[model samples]
Target: MNNTYITSFDYQVPIDKIPIAELRQVFIDDFSDHVDDLESPKFQNITLDEIEAVSVYQNYNPGTEVISVIEKVLTDKSDGRELDLIIDYSVVSKLENGLSIGNKIQEQLNARNALVLSVGNGGCLSFMLALKTAQAFMQANDQYKNVLLFSEDHVIGNRYNPGLNVLGDGASAILLQSETDSTMQLVDVECYNMGRLNPVLGVRHDLKGNFKYKEFENKIQPLHYKVIYDLFNKVLRNNSLKIEDIDLVLYQNMSHNDYVGLKSALQLSEDQLHYGKMKGHGHVFGSDIIINMCHSTEQGKLEKAKNIVAISSGAGFSWAVSLIKN
Candidate 1:
């Protein structure tokens, strides 16, 4: 009841190939196509597969590439349908000057002059929250038909981050339609803000004059699972379903051990918790959940998913779950 409920949806879920939860994502890293391994050796064991940092982009304009990526997704996946609205979830979207990017996108994409809005919410959870916002907009009003929720992020300063997993950049474009059933439909959603763990934007200059990216994931580590347990239980209860009743559960990619710990804590079967994406992409900040959903569907893991649950937690200190029914 607290989340948006769209009555319609339309889209073909690809049983093969990389495509949404259809999704087209691109990562521009200084490390090239190879998984960029970090130089840090102290916490290597704890970080594990997530040690590879997608890093940053200095050559190409990130904003421009993001727009380009969105254009490609629209060209290939939009199916000639015009957009009703665009919700951008990214770190740069918070900039006062960054607002123009939205306008440029709207004008360039032939989106039919759809409204463009920015959601500066960070972390993977921010992406889900943005998706929920789009779903809610269509639910609350019928004027908006299909919505495009785009997420993009880049670390502005250092190439390697000691905080958590992702110290890189990525962009994802997802199409959410109204009044149809071909793609995943938003059944229910829940979001809770724990508090601000990272600054809204900008990097700090330390005594050495090096740009520093700060993260406070350690502060709430103790209460993390408790919050996840309660948040998920509420969403499941709202849908009148239980963990066993759901076919698949996907969480944002983090460390391999993090996934193992979460699966055990949530009492999820191996099939339910699909965290294999972590090995390949590491943590992609806000785009992790969307990419993971696309990964699961293409791998045919999502084929068995009827009442699938996708959840994520972000440095914005927010947790969110979106229950989708096939």
Candidate 2:
């Protein structure tokens, strides 16, 4: 079951990246006075530098551009690798108004006609869906020597809610192959979902007419680490492995608090975790997993690991995990 470690994983992003936006502007029919006011120092004195420093609001969704970045990562190192994609339902679900996210992705990758080997919904279980997709695709396509696994998502599904700060707009691509190289190896995977907790994290509409974030300040919501730690232990127990055997623990960065709790719950030292810091990247939705992997590669932090486990949890009350040997 040992193969070459994940040799190279890369990513790209558009320069003109736009963030999800919200604005409160009242329209004025008699615009002359309003225009005069807008032209005053209150508005005119504002410099582009200051504006740039201030985060811009995103009114449009980022889809193909993000997927394009994922494809870039795949094709860059895909010379001898197979391609598999684990797409989160949120990327293309009608409820989120993302019906075209998947097809647009296929078009960006020139894979519109490619066989849909497997498809599943993570419901907030994005990580599990991804791993399940990888397992199924590998089993179904033995001849598929090189595989490309990818996932992309936007923050629009959460209605641009500020509470979902950890969620960002991004995409990820991992090139897999039958032969081993210097890259990280895909050892095994374990996944589960807590659908009962689905109501705690989601997008809902209120009288204001826009979607609102649900669970931003719930202290108990972070108890998800207990759920994740239990599932992780279950996976290790099933495979006769121990947490100490794991060299690195890559978990989704929900927030600083989640990371701290997960670290204590998992009994992991600080070095065992990847860059768990919550930057302004704004909770990249489902792309955080690969994003962290790519960051590790860039920082040369992935070495000295015999085994590494990746864990991801999302709002659908879902969880996905995988064990990789480096």
Note the Cα lDDT for every prediction shown. 0.60, 0.51
- Best-fitting candidate, measured by TM-score? 1
lDDT digits (tens) for residues 1-326 of candidate 1:
22333322112111122211011123223322322333334234563434443433444353555665566555544542367788877644333454525555666576765888876654557677777778778778877776777765655533333324444456677777664435556777788876544442222212121322222333556667888899889998998998898888888766677787789889998878887564434556667776777788679987678888888886556778778887
Question: Candidate 1, 299: how far from true, in Å?
Answer: 1.2
Best by lDDT: 1
True-structure lDDT of candidate 1: 0.60
lDDT tens digits, residue span 207-241, model 2: 13232122323432566667778888987887789
